[model samples]
Target: MAKGDDLDPKGLIEESYKIEGISTAECRSIFLDWALSYQGVSAVGIAALLARHGLGTDHHPMTITLREGLLAPHAPKRRGGRRGRVVD
Candidate 1:
């Protein structure tokens, strides 16, 4: 895999790949950290990170997490709650 880039400033994604038999949940946590640490837009960062890593159906947890992140919705939907009912 390519060296950690600005998208993964903490090297969380790179280290996640090194972890053998890492669970998807763990990867998700790492991805969250990576996402929070990254300054640029997530889609752009994720795409660049994937390209740098040269991943293709490797079934690696990090790969799965990155792909899932891409597929995930951009806008977070509000679940039914008091906050959801609040209005200006």
Candidate 2:
């Protein structure tokens, strides 16, 4: 994972926000791609990066969706079940 200055040299996040009429779903996809590419960066870090680049998610619906998607808690997996049945 790239750090500090190396985070997004390609400016993908900026481009995503520049697209006219882009939807929240599209932003989510773009955000996912961006996040996945930066292995060491946390979601909060990404948000801060976007903000520093003038694409803050706070006022934008699409960006807000991306932020929420990144920060949303993961669902817990069930430990022993095929539809909750015991394996014995």
Candidate 1 lDDT for residue 80: 100
Q: Which stretches of candidate 2 lie over 4 Å from their true place?
A: 1-5, 53-57, 77-88
Candidate with top TM-score is 1
Write model 1 residue lDDT over 48-88, tens digit each, in one string: 87886645646887887788888967897679988789996
Clashing pairs in 1: none
Worst 10 residues of 2 by lDDT: 1-10
Count of clashing residue pairs in every prediction: 0, 0
Writing each residue's lDDT as its tens digit, candidate 2 over 1-88 gives 2223456555666676667877777777767776677656566656666566544446664567655756669899877758568556
- True-structure lDDT of candidate 1: 0.81
Using lDDT, give the best candidate's number: 1
